[model samples]
Target: MNITLKPTPEIILTGDRATGPLHLGHYVGSLKQRVFLQSQHEQTILVADMQGLTDNAHNPAKVSSNILNVVADYLAVGINTEQTTICLQSQLPALAELTMYYSNLVSIARLERNPTVKAEIQSKGFERAIPAGFLTYPISQAADITAFNATLIPVGDDQLPMLEQTNEIVRKINHLANKKVLNECRPLLSNAPRLPSTDGKNKMSKTMGNTINLGASEKEISAAVKAMYTDPNHLRVQDPGQVEGNIVFTYLDAFHSDKDYVEQLKSQYRRGGLGDGTTKKILEECLQSLLGPIRNKRAEYLNDKAQLMAILKQGSQAAKEKTEKTLFDVKAVFGLNIL
Candidate 1:
């Protein structure tokens, strides 16, 4: 009689698309959490170059160029390579294989019904001519999660549907296997609220020119803060200000160290004594201090591209071993493991 050992139950898998340099929104939403989680759990951070290509297939350079930038951003935010396995998605053949197998379990209509997918398709204006890859990337994401047996995935509220889809695949795989071949995962939702774009019109987006990158220079940071959206109704400093939608206070609430002080400012602004310039000045100072060291460290990492590539190569090797084992098990269950 043989008894198989279950994979570790606390592994975490998360990543970013290699589309652009990361921004404060990424830091608050997931990067900061990644830093803390690396030490507590077995974490794998994939630079998702393949997924980044779902929409950028016409411009592959957009994804290829930012692979190192994403990794540098990871290192800058204190994601120690020693603790977190940072691998390039395109380097992991097992993940692609797993994605191929998982794809059979999902259908086009099901993918179309995915709210996240629908929203993305509408936003990208891919309505009728949506790339097959873009429509099916959720299945690929499911493969990424299960390949490492990840049990905790860091995500924002908007991403819960993606995880729901992942677990749906998990259930199908396990049901087909007649045993626990895959582990169901949960979302480690961030406590931080979504950081709005500096313009206050949408979520922070790299394409919109509305975000302050993690690698932003001091001058750029100052300009972005100065241009932050504030209450249009408050034309005078003496007029009562609205704190609810003001981008300055929203940023302060997100980044400033002193919560009590931010609340005080909110109260003062509501009563008509505080000026938007004063709030923007303080927010700028807070952001400058927070991002200054990160910018320097990121530059240091990018300066050594050879070392960065080596790090990714080593991680991909380790990840290959793990994911290959999973692939073997899944295939064996499907009676397709003749190799």
Candidate 2:
């Protein structure tokens, strides 16, 4: 509901933690939209390695191994590096410095109050021994946004509280530091909210074993598509089906080209005439059409590992310049500037 009206060519901060390869949920939920925004906004796609290390500290190799995989996933999904700055979060020192300052602006209790954090904690099953870094991630995210002076943050509705918390930190820091160093960020909500997995059990996630990777081969995607959940009530071909809760239809609505045809199919399905196999075949074809090119592109990048890292390094350097300048101004305000 809170849409940006005059949509200026402002900076945007959006990315995923490089803990694993991105999946379809990641595409529909954010990355696909980010691909379009890259042309319109001054976008920065962060591979949040620092954040990834918070929970994955014990498995540093997992974090290290997935960075390129994540980059591959981005490129595979048509995210142009020339238009969007793709930077590794752990490589940015300014972000760390900014996080240190922001930590003072927020209370421990406030971090506990963040709904996003609460949900993450429960999902991760970290009830008692929550890591300090994990608990303070919202502040670190605030630092990431403010360090880049990012005005637009593309996130899902579940992360609205995170945007609110970041703005609150911005206001608090600006007043406390006696300088308006941080800019308030607006949430560019994904048109598709949280996408459910093929299993229809929970949100599509890497850990849930229900995701179809963005770079999956056509054959692999077909196998996954065949197992996708549909209307349970419509057990047989002649049973009246429901499209409202069908994930197959949801994917079609999100990705398919022929919307009218899909709508007609849904109507027929509900009228107890259409077969589930027929509908699934349509869904499979739609998905294959979308994913085939992405798989090819990912294969190309995976073959040339050095070239991929070069692009990442180049983008990281460019992003560092912007963050360094912002960190300098923030430090100057706090009188932490050594020279």
Candidate 3:
């Protein structure tokens, strides 16, 4: 009798670049999912300092300095270190080797054609001066996902293309080996709406200075909420407000935790009685309440950088074992595992 064993079904891999602190955008989209998924799945969060440098190579300090900041944000958002492994990308040797090996399996044209990489290249105006590392980071990303045999990747719609590219590499590698040497991962799409920048014109981003950081102070939170874009046409309290692009209302919908109350506010505003000041005040209170504890916890974690590093070290050590095994398996398939 012959039997077949199935691969693990729900290992998770997700993380942020070490460029800056996490903001409300992170919380609403990915962090919340990480908090929930950590308990249910085998999860690993990579502080991708290496990927961060693909763009910030000139500012290496930015990446190195924020590695722990990113980890602290993970902890601040309720990702328990014991349940979810949090490791720095630069500390993982196997990921780099896997990337080098996988690069042969991906073409530069395919890399350039990736929608996410293309959009980022155009946004950064790298027109002709695109860094080799920037273009190839998707391969590194594939290495990241497959190293741990991650089967469910948490990502937004814009990131779906990257996952497609990852599976493409997995298929190519498996086909070359003529067996199921690697597991193809799937995207755990976030149902949460994308949080816009406080300016309301773009998505929330740390580089744009238009996001509310998870660790923002009370004063900063108030100022950001007050400065949020609302209906420009509704200049007076008597004028009917447009809720569609109103940043405050959008935020209220995302975080106020009371759908009925938010709907009531929207109805009142559209009927021409609600004022922006009143609306902004409601949103500010919700934000202050939401972020106050996260800010405190983040500060507490940052105070003891030694402990943060220790946590990362422990995660990286465990991650190294998984990634190294994957690397060896791949090399064995290619007949290069002689040593």
Q: How much lDDT does candidate 2 score?
A: 0.87
Per-candidate TM-score against the hidden true structure: 0.95, 0.95, 0.96
Cα RMSD (angstroms) for every candidate in the order listed: 4.3, 3.2, 3.6
Candidate 1 Cα errors over 4 Å, as ranges: 1-9
Instruction: Put down candidate 2 lDDT per residue, 1-339, tens digits, no spaces.
Output: 897786569799998988888888888888878888888889999999999999999999888999999998898888898799888998899999889988987899999999889999999999879999999999889889888899999887888998898899889878877878779999987778677788888766666668888888788788887888888788888889899879888888888888899889989989988987898899898888888888888889988999889989998999899999989987877888887
How high is the lDDT of residue 126 in model 3? Answer: 100
Taking the tens digit of each residue's C-alpha lDDT, what string does model 1 give over 1-339? 999875554799999999999999998888888888887789999999999999999999999999999899999989998899999899888888988988999999999999988998998899989999999999999999999999999888878988998999999989999999999999988999888999999767777789999999999999999989999898888889999989998889989999999999999999998899899999999999999999999999999999899999999999999999998988887899786
Worst 10 residues of 1 by lDDT: 3-12
> Judged by lDDT relative to the true structure, which candidate is superior, 1 or 2?
1
1-339 per-residue lDDT for model 3 (tens digits): 887775454899999989888899889989998998888789999999999999999989998988888888999989998799998888889899989989998998999899989999999999779999999998999999999999999999998998998999999989999999999998989999888899988756766779999989999999998889999999999889999989999899989999999999999999999999999999999999999999999999999999999999999999999999999988887899887
lDDT of 1: 0.92
